[model samples]
Target: MILHGYWRSGASYRVRIGLGLKGLAYQTAALDLRKGEQKAPAFLAINPQGMTPALQQGETVLTQSPAILEWLEETHPEPPLLPKDAQDRAQVRAMAALIGCDIHPLNNLRVLTALRQEFGADQATVDAWAGRWITPGFDALEVLVARHGAGWSFGDRPGLADCYLIPQLYSARRFNLALTPWPRLLAVEAAAQAHPAFQAAHPDRQPDADG
Candidate 1:
C-alpha cells in the first residue's frame, strides 16, 4: 500500500495513526501542501478532490480519511477501532464525526487560505476564525467524552474517537485554544500521546515535517 499525504494534515494524521495501530507496512508519498503539490495532476489523478491522505492498494484507491479509516477497521480487525456493540459503535462514530466533520473542515489549510486570499483575513483574523469553530465544538466534545469516556475517549482502549480527538487537540493547541477547561479531553490526549502508535504518527515524527 502507498499512502499519499502532507505532514501537518489532520486527516493524514488520523490515517497514519490507524496504520500504526494496525501495524500495516506501507510506503508514504508526501505531498507538499504548502507548495500546492496536492493540486498537481499526478495527485489529482489519484484523488480528484485533491485532498491529502489518499491510500492506494494495488489498483484500489481510497480517498477521504473517514472512509479509509473504516476500510482499515474492516480489513484489520484484530486491534479493533470500533466498539463491539452497535450502540457503542454509533457513539464512537458520533464523537469522531464531531471532530472530523464539524470542526476540521472549517480550519483546514484550504479554508484558512481562502480566509486570507479571498476574505481579506489576516493571520490573527484567521486564527480567530478557527478558534470560533473549534472552541464550541470542543466544548460539546468535553461534555460528551466526560459522560462516556474512561481512560481513553470512549473506553479504556484507544479507539476511533481517540484517533480523531488527539489530532483535533493538536489543532486546538496550534490555534492557542485553552484546554484547561476540558480536563477529560486533555486526559484522553495524554493517554493517546503516551501510546507508541500515536507517537509514531505525530506530525513532528513525519518524514516531510517542516521544522
Candidate 2:
C-alpha cells in the first residue's frame, strides 16, 4: 500500500495513526502541500478532490480519512479500533465525528487559505479564527472524554477516537491554543504519547516534515 499525504495535514495524521494501529506496513508518498503539490495534475488524477491521505492498494485507490479508517477497521479486525458493544462503538464514532466533522472542517488548510485570500485575514486573525472553533469543540470533548475515556479517548485501549483526537490536539497546539481546559483529553494525549502507534504516526516524525 502507498499512503499519499502531507506531513502536517491533520487528516493525513489521522490516517497514519489508523494504519499504525492496524500494524500495516505501507510506503509514504509525501505531497508537499506548501507547494500546492496536492492540486497538481498527477495528484488530481489519483483523487479529483485534490486532497491528501489518499491510500493506494494495487488497483484500488481510497480517498477520505474516515472511509480509510473504516476500511482499516473492517479489514484488520485484530486489536480492534472499536469496542465490542454496539453502543460503545457508536460513542467512539461520535467522538471521532466531533473532531472530524465539527472542528476540523472549519480550521482546515483550505478554509484558512480562503480566509486569507478572500477576506484579508492576517496571521492573528487566522489564529483567532482557529481558536473560535477549537475552544468550543474542545470544551465539549473535555466533557465527553471525562464521561467515556478510561486511558484512551473512549476506553482503556487506543481506538478510533484516539486516532481522531490526537491529531486534533496536535492541530490545537499548532494553532497556539492553551489545552489547560481539557485535562481528560490531555490524559488521553499523554496515553497516546507513550503508545508506539501514535508515536510512529506523529506529524513531526514524518519523512517529509523537515522540508
Candidate 3:
C-alpha cells in the first residue's frame, strides 16, 4: 500500500491512525500541498480531485477519508474501530461524521486558501472563520461527550468517534480553538495521545513534519 498524504491534513492524520491501529505496513508518498503539487498533472492522474490521501492498495485506489476508514475497518477487524451492536455502530459513525462532515470540510486547506485569496481574507480572518464555525460544532460535541463518553468518546474502548475526534481536536488546537470548555474532549485527546498508534500518527511525527 502506498499512502499519499500531506503531513498536516487532518483526514490524512485519521488514515494514519487507522493504519497504525491495525499495524498495517505501507509506504508513504508525501505531497507538498503548500507547493501546489496536489494540483499537478502527475498527481491528478492518480486522483482527479487532486486530493491528498489517495491510498493505493495494489491496483485498487481509494479516496475520501471516511470511505477509506470504513474500508480499513472492514478489512482489518481485530482491533475493531466500530462497535458490535447495530445502534452503537450508528452512534460511533454519527460522531465521526460530526467531525469529518460538519467541521472538517469548513476548515480544509482549499477553503482557507479561498477565504484568503478569493475573498480577501487575511490569516487572522481565516483563523477567525475556522473558529467561528468550529465553536458551535465543538459546543455540540461537548454536549455529546458529556452525555455519551465513557473514558473515550463512545466508550472505554477507542471507537470510530475517537479516531476522528482526536485528530479534529488536534486541528482545533492548531487553529487556536479554545478547548478548556470541552473537558471531555480534552480528556479523550489526552488518553488517545497516550496510545502508541495515535502517538505515532501525530502530525509532528509524520515524515513531512517541518522542524
Candidate 4:
C-alpha cells in the first residue's frame, strides 16, 4: 500500500496514527501541499481532489481520511479503532467529526492561503482566524469529554476519537491556540502521545517531516 500525504497535514496525521495502531505496513508518497504539488497532473490522476492522505492498495485508490480510517478499522480489527457498542461508536465518530469537520477545515492550509490571497490577511491575522474556529470547537469537545471521560474519549483504550484528537491538538500548538481551558482534552492528548503507536506516527517522525 502507498499512502500519499503531506508532513504537517492534520488529516494525514490522523491516517498515520490509524495505520500505526493497526500495525499496517505501507509506503509514503509525499505531496508538498504548500508547494502545490498536490495539484500536479500526476497526483490529480490518483486523487481528483488532490488531497493528502490518499491511499493506494493494489488497484484500489482511496481518499478522505475518515473513509480510509474506517477501511483500516474494518480490514484490520485486531486493535479495534471503534467500540462494539453503537452508542460508543457514535460518540467516537462525533468527537472525530468535531475536529475533522468543525475545526480542521477552517484551519487547513488551503483556507489559510485563501485568507491571505483573497482577504489580504497578514500572518498574525490568519492565525487569529484559525484560533477563532479552534477555540469554539475545542470548547464543545471539552464539554462532551467531561461527561464521557472514560479515561479515553469513548473509553479507556484509544479509539477513533483519540486518533483524530491528537492531530488537532498538534495543530492547536502549531497555531498557539490556548489549551488551558480544555483539561479533558489535554488528558486525552497525553494518553495518545504516550502510546507507542501515536508516538511513532507523529509528524516529526514521518519520512517527509521537516526539522
lDDT of 4: 0.90
Q: What value does the lDDT take at residue 86 in candidate 2?
A: 97
Query: By lDDT, highest first, what's the ranking?
Result: 2, 1, 4, 3
Write one digit per residue (lDDT tens) for candidate 3, span 1-211. 9999998999998999898888898888999898999999988988999998899977788998899989999989978988889988888898889899899999988899888888899878888888887888888888888877889888787777887888898888878877897888899998987899889889998888998
Q: Is candidate 3 or candidate 4 better by lDDT?
A: 4
Best by lDDT: 2
Model 1: residues >4 Å from true position, as ranges? none
lDDT of 2 by residue, 1-211 (tens): 9999988999999999999999999999999888899999988999999998899998789999999999999999988999999999999999899999999999988899999999999988998999998888889988888899888888689999999999999998888888998889999999899999999999899999974
TM-score of every model? 0.97, 0.98, 0.96, 0.97
TM-score between model 1 and native: 0.97
Q: What is the C-alpha local distance difference test score of each model?
A: 0.91, 0.92, 0.88, 0.90
- Residue 52, model 1, lDDT: 88
How far off is model 2, as Cα RMSD? 0.9
Backbone clash count for every predicted candidate, in the order shown: 0, 0, 0, 0
Q: Please estimate how well model 1 matches the true structure, expressed as its whole-model Cα lDDT.
A: 0.91
Give residue 3's error in model 2 in angstroms: 0.2
What is the Cα-based TM-score of model 3? 0.96
Candidate 1 local lDDT, 4-87, one digit each (tens): 998889999999999988989888899999999999998899889998899998878999999999999998997999999999
